[model samples]
Target chain A: MRGSKAVVGVYSYLDDLLKGIADIRSADLDYKVYSPAYRHEIEEATLPGKSSVRRFTLTGGIIGCTFGWTLAILCSLDWPLRVSAKDIVSPPGFFVIGYECTILFGALATLGSLLLYCGLPNFLRKVGYDPRFSRDKFGLVVGCDGHNLEDVKGRLMKSGADEVNVTEGI
Target chain B: MSKQSEKKEVSYAMVNDLVLRMLEPPGAGWWVLLLTCITLLSWGAVSFAYQLWAGYGMAGNAHPIGWGTYITNFVFWVGIAHSGTLISAVLYLFRAKFRMPIYRLAEAMTVFAVMTAGLFPLIHVGRPWMALWLMPYPNERALWPNFRSPLLWDVFAVSTYFTVSAVFFFVGLVPDIAAARDRAKTFFRKMLYGVASLGWTGNNTQWKHFIAAYLLFAGLATPLVVSVHSVVSWDFAMSIVPGWHATIFPPYFVAGAIFSGVAMVMTLIIPLRKVFKLEPLIREEHFDAMSKLILLTSSIVAYAYITEFYVAWYSNNMFERFQFWFRPFGEFAVAFWGMAFCNCIAPLALWYGPLRRNIAFLFVLSIIINIGMWLERFNIIFTSLAREYIPAAWGSYNFSWVEIGITFGAFGWFGMWMTLFIKFFPAVAITEIKEILPPPVRNKESLQGHH
Candidate 1:
């Protein structure tokens, strides 16, 4: 397991590193990119698409609206107590509750979907992580066979990686 | 690649060093402050316990003036909570780059202030255990909280605001927590950071989802910044009380909330930046920008004050007119005049550029405005209820020592939480600042030379 994956490149500048990723993409090497901050360059180079998180927000809002209206209406109907001659089920008043629920559920759903998508709360520490990536440095973990380890290391070094770490056996 | 700005260069290591330094153990001075807050908080707890034992009569509540200092404190703290969302969500949506350094503290303040505000209603209700009745959960009684009631609306609005804001705050912390985790030397610190970080790897995939989720939350929270305070306003406006029942309550409350919120932010951050040596990160420009907002909102609040009186006179409603007149010349004249001076007049100083830039002036002004905002609430609650429609029911209410102690305790509680938060978590958003920074200087030469 330890002899499988090969090199990790720590780049100080995001632009050069992103270009390095573009080069890796052209070569079709399996790789992971890490940065301290979210960068559009990385997004364009790597995960290029509209995030699917929006669907969760939309669906959650719909569910929330339905839940809000249904709950308010059902509760009113259950009691059937007419207050101040108003109707039992007041849609106008319930709209406030519905609006609040929409935001509440939508935010919750967004957070839930985010955690699900990111595979977060993972207690186990995965290998091939460089501590410097959490600081100023950008990191690339390129998966390589024994034969391509040297080639991958050289490619990352040539692309202006400040330092490259070689790890063996996954 | 986007062209880098030729601004003062900041490296990621510099940010890490500056922010993570806050996570170090507190000094003797910090311990002294924490101890004082804890002492005050304990006194507040004792006061509350006494209230629980002695009953609501311990506070100043009688015939016409059923609502008193408790309600005033509730509204004040809620108003204080509003600025955080405005700075964090509204400013974020507008792409205010300066919000990066200070928004984290403001957001934390919002959460803690709301927590303090939430306690008031529970205490006001007297039977704290039965306060859960405000919730719409299914029960054997087959009764639901009255949705038509503004108080019930407040229940949903405030709770929703709290939940969303807390989640938003924590979401922003994920990356910073990971940074802290990597830098942790002690095993205990490492374990704590590791769990809190939620296995954040800062990979492109995580960043993508994080940003998307953050944007959605910001959008969701933006409306809440308006709605929460609006619903809180309706608690007064929906009533038939003269000063309380105004059509202008919603926007007026929103503006005042933001006004007081910014003032409170200034109150907290002025000292914090000095203590943490975050002057570089939280620049003078940020203070200038915030002061401008404070000025804008204060003007709106001042306008609301005038409009309230104008509408009262224009309507030719005797009670409304009397209420407005009574505010300035009546029993609570001192409070009304003080509020006007502090809220309306004091903020006028910011009109001068030098005053806004002067940290001493801004700090003093912020304290004065906070006092003015509190008085504003006090005047509204006390004056309106004291002299309502029925003359026979007219009564004056005074603050009992118990209520005063409890209010002080709320402040202590809020301060204590914030002090602890600053110690454990990065008060500033590390990742956000990194995003806005010019590309690292050392890295730039190496990369450009290669190209």
Candidate 2:
């Protein structure tokens, strides 16, 4: 983002990280938290409400269920090649295809939603990134105006940020 | 030995280093193994090429045994795939902590096994190139594949299983791949990890969705694991073949799949734990837990075997009765009895806790169970087809070099992928292992005075 300034807080301990998150929240600033692994405590502290990935799964499953049956039934009717003298539209037989499609599509959609929400393949968006975030360190990035940049950095340092930096144009 | 003590000792950085170490440049042993796999794969490929050149008659598949060695190989490999999903998805949902260290490799095994299994159908079709006709694509003829046919169900089920599994496997690898990307030295490896990781930074937004999506994938996959084998079972059960037409084939096949799959996991992981020196992470307790699963599934399989016989007798059907009798006393009696000893009797040793925990014993038993499982499928496919409803129409399968070569190649194929995977990817999950470890915490006294 052009002209945007942010304060980055790097921490060594989970306790300090949670405290850092508390400080950012109390200030009512827009912030993003980073960690090496998923923690229920961090999730409970930083994010509100549940992830919307479930909606994508439900939508994909419904679409897949519809598509599977339509493809099976309509194709069977179009061809009209009866095997074993079974019914023209065999729901029992098609149920297997439908079930498999539901899972296949649901899984694909879940992956899609994850990518979209996470801004994945984001090769160029690395203004506040730290390699240690993937290893042992936790980070807290709070986006604020240039005027509030020093104030935010000071607060983050007091909030137990082992290292704090101000980055412009992030 | 308690998990609590182990959790305290392992650090996040150590988990990263230990896992990434496996991704280091291969040693001589690894190259030799890779060469062996490649050589075997080439031999299988040569056999297949020769078969394609000479015609379908090059293989032993004949009048009565149309679904011969190729089908057996297909079912065998698909069975090998079951334990991966069972461990990664099902155990994950149940919060089985032992799965943490081994599930990554298990999931990789599942994807590669499915890839190997997917090839058999193409190879079985003989023409191989015409396999695309199996899909429900638009054509000038306006004819779709018969959805009512269990064969068509196999196509859909297997393809769906493969797609979902590969997706699940890759999704789980993202964070670990990111870790590898950060530590990667070589430019090629760095680029590979960078692209594969999708630039994951472990932000809370990403973790929140990643966790949710992973949970949903596991839920979707658990039922998929059961349905896939069941659909594979329907390929046989839907037929009027005496040995295969039983109602119990779904659960029987599924339990057998898990039995064989878990055995395969043990087969792979025992060697892996030693080679990678991951004993601290993949402990004896994990094997013990896995053995218990094998024991449970083995009992189910044994019951299925007896039930097949009892049902055959109770049905008063001459063909079914004859099929059951011939399985134990006929030309392929060795396969039936071998399967019985390996699958039913061998796993009984696991009921003894000491044997389960003994890594050496588990490794040997795993190989035995795998052999027995292959024999079980062979017994079901070959014996059942070798003598069907009519004695005059019945004929034995011709053991041809083509099928043998192809079967050997299939193992090479699976082995080659596995050998390469361990060297390239973090065989052990870096992130999940760290997740289970106690997080670094500042002292409460120090924190109490802060904010």
Candidate 3:
């Protein structure tokens, strides 16, 4: 819940959504912060950790393509093929298409992964989201209920959320 | 708020205002106009008129060689177009700082060069009216072009290249267009720039998409420089002519294309930088870098030359060997030496830093190099064919006034187009220059260290 609902929070103490609720006494009122396991996986993949598939997009793609393609064509030599009285692996014939396909696949994979990493489609994004988020608010979110909302408002004030507001309907 | 953001736009006609000072020649030399450009344009024009009336055969071309000066020029101009994409896309991908001014000029050169090139295929047509038949379709006329032909592949390659280069050129021009749109007093310029700008607001998201499209187009078009010329080379390689049938032709041609294209760029830019007072913008550093490239490609070009001769010698196929070696010593020797001197020898002046930085020396050298490169093409095509496999079939080409006229007029046409373009449009990309300049001296206090 700390990273969810279009909010990014960096907490000084353990007043963050998960920790605050876990430590809630009877006087603190009731609440829960969703922490699904897959959230951790996505959070780990994105933003935080060094371990990632993203780094392989360009370099790994090039290596896999060139050597992979060279092996494929070289192995095809044993499969006896003849077109117009020409031998299979005469060395000169293999260079042209071999070089062309290697570049083609490497370029294609790099292009695809670059798109995924950037999260870019539809070409435009919403800006100037909320005024309060710029001033003193470290994080602002929508949808905190009234009972827990009041108690949550107090916690937010204590934690310096700046200007907390009730967010019910769209 | 939207209305207020629009008001802060600044406009200035930077440095020289050549059009306003009409009497003076805007610092550009008279010799450039008289020689390379003007001569070429007018000769091509007169020849074109003769061509329209009498037909293409008047250009000294006969049954065995139906294509002549026009086809050669097409290859030359298309080769010239490569450097713009090379500088803009490849260097941009590599983040080379020297590309800034030259890149835009290269694109302009590309568009003009392609325009000049596309004319030849039409003019060379046996039936000019049937030119549209090359467009891909299975038509009711119950005819289709041979799909297997390299000529048709050229149709795809060139058209794709033109579209992509044109888009890349315009996408990069948006900021400059916005500036022009703001400053333009006339309705036509305002409207033209307005439409060209496409409401570019310089917001971060707009920049993201704009750059994405630009880089994408550049990447797509980059290999085409190699592909287009290689495919063109295949037209010769795919042939059964002894000297022409070598497997080495594609890479050889590609290397030659790059070599010549850089030579052409040097020829154009040396004069332009002088005339426009762009010494600061198109700096000595830029010259040094290109001179190195010119030298490098020249050596590659020279290397290709040696290999062609050596292979012809080593192959032990007597007809092939004689056809290759006899080129420099025989009838085409002048063209062969001219090619060698221009591409290989002339650029060697760049070995010294002083010569590399000297605009006048570089300018003269570039001209010589272009001549050599042009001769290189003439040598390759004519020499190989003039002495084909059988001696009985051997014949030589002598250019008639008609052929000479068309060649002259092609240059004239290119000059007229380039001359007009430079006259009206802001020749330099101003806004881009502003962006690249070391972050502006924010305030007086910030400038303290410089003093």
Candidate 4:
């Protein structure tokens, strides 16, 4: 967002994309990488930390579990209606409901965390996006000052960018 | 692995095209099939309306057989939903590569099948409008649903299963939907895919969270899948009725559910693959793997069948023994025998390696397995209730035309969702399929040049 111009590198091969990412990192340019599919090699190259989505899942599951048991136990005790001479508060039966809630809440939370972290429905800014990136291409987008834009473009091309485009204001 | 990719010769762009092409304007056949589904769904709707008007007696539920075809269909559809989760979530945890192409379809099946299954309990209750009372919300009467009852457990389990599976299905669809959005030419399609894809760009951050969350969904779903069917089984097993009360019912029902579900998957995929010309993606190897699964589950089901009979005899309980005896020898012997043939005997043909890979044989066998699974449920529900402890209390369920129409209509309901899904969304996972393909890489010379 600080830069007035950005350099975009379109890559057909993953190897070239990785090389470009390495170059941009060395040059200390803020950049983003895009791919047609998830790849471990890209993750290894980009070095984004482990996603925190798991924390959301764990927290959601625990809350769901607690809520499930409380609801079931409280509802059972409220009436104190005994059937089949079973216990007044049945953990065994309630466990089924609790287990299901754990999954339901866990999954919904994961989705919420994914959307929040990924900045989805991002209609505000779509700079440097290419349709081919969703099909077969890898894209490296580097934001830089207008004066340094040529240097960034040169570095990307040297690292093996198939095509490079420089646009004003990313 | 590189050599394998070289031999197969598929690329990322080709994968996108292959799957996205399925979302194109439908052909005559698709329209014809869609029309057929609507016609059948109308039949089911009219039947249900008549049942509502005429009273619960319009169907077969009478005397001891209070639960009839509606309950049977409920179990059947729920069982059918099991395979979707098994393939989509369980196989994913195993990192089974063969599931890459077919799991999307199976996951969709799981969602739609559960939607179809959720309707039955309402239909069975005779007062579909008052179904909300089953929920534990605070009421004016201050009456809470019985927490210990297996029926109450079912409301929680099945609803949770549907929610989780639908979320899993949609999460997997997001990236593929983005791919479709890129290829879409029409304005309405543009907005639809734009919103549905949630503006996915498959960037590093998006893929990072996406992969992490997807793994967690799979992990959570795997246990839930097993538990959901077990809860469904407990609705019968918790009852004191001789044949219904058994510890083995959980595993028995789970295996049978997967067996029938995988067959249902085959029943769907064979025709879909042919029509879409997805032979290279959904290869014989996938079907071979699916058939082996059917074989494994069929063996378990057959063993459970034997165990049911053995336990009945070994327990020295005459009621249990009589229920087991009457299943194959009494008035409903045809259903029991038919289930035995379809569930136990029919899948034995898959033992042959050649037949396991044969598409036509698998399709026919899948339909037979589905029918057999349905009959298996029918036998369990009808036979146990028909002759309980006292002979004087014995009864038979009368199958009315309404029941038959509604049963066929459930298929229409399921089929209608599937038909519309295939047209609007990417029925196959474009991104996952591309993930398995060789990454687009420059020649060795180019890599050395970069270094």
Each prediction's Cα lDDT score? 0.89, 0.91, 0.59, 0.91
Which candidate gets the maximum DockQ versus the true structure?
Answer: 4
lDDT tens readout by residue for model 1, A1-170: 23487588989877669768987888898888899888876887898898999999999999998988888888888778887788888887788899899999999999999999998888774557777888988988888888888888888988888989888755
| Model 3 residue B139 distance off true place after TM-score fit, in angstroms | 1.8
Q: Report the candidate with higher lDDT, 2 versus 3.
A: 2
- DockQ, prediction 3: 0.03
Candidate achieving the largest TM-score: 4
| B34-79 per-residue lDDT for model 4 (tens digits) | 9999999999999999999999899998988888999999999999
Q: For each candidate in turn, give its C-alpha RMSD to the true structure in angstroms.
A: 2.9, 2.2, 11.8, 2.1
- Chain B TM-scores per candidate, in order, are 0.96, 0.97, 0.88, 0.97
Q: Which ten residues in a row have the lowest lDDT in candidate 4 chain B?
A: B442-451
**Model 1: CA > 4 A from native:** A1-3, B1-7, B441-451
lDDT of 3 by residue, B1-451 (tens): 4423322222123312321122123334545665567777667667777777887667777634455566777777777777777877887778787787677777777777777778778777756678899864546865444333467656656765676677667667665655555456677776776676554433222334344544555665677678877877877887778778888888887777777777777877777776666655677778888888888888888888888888988989998888877788998899888888888777887888898878788888877877787787787777877787777787878688976776667667767666665644555655445444432221435334433
What level of docking quality does candidate 3 show? incorrect
Q: Is the docking of candidate 2 incorrect, acceptable, medium or high quality?
A: medium
TM-score of candidate 4 on Cα atoms, chains taken together = 0.98
Quote model 1's TM-score.
0.97
- Quote each prediction's TM-score: 0.97, 0.97, 0.69, 0.98
Clashing pairs in 1: A1-A169, A1-A170, A2-A168, A2-A169, A2-A170, A3-A169
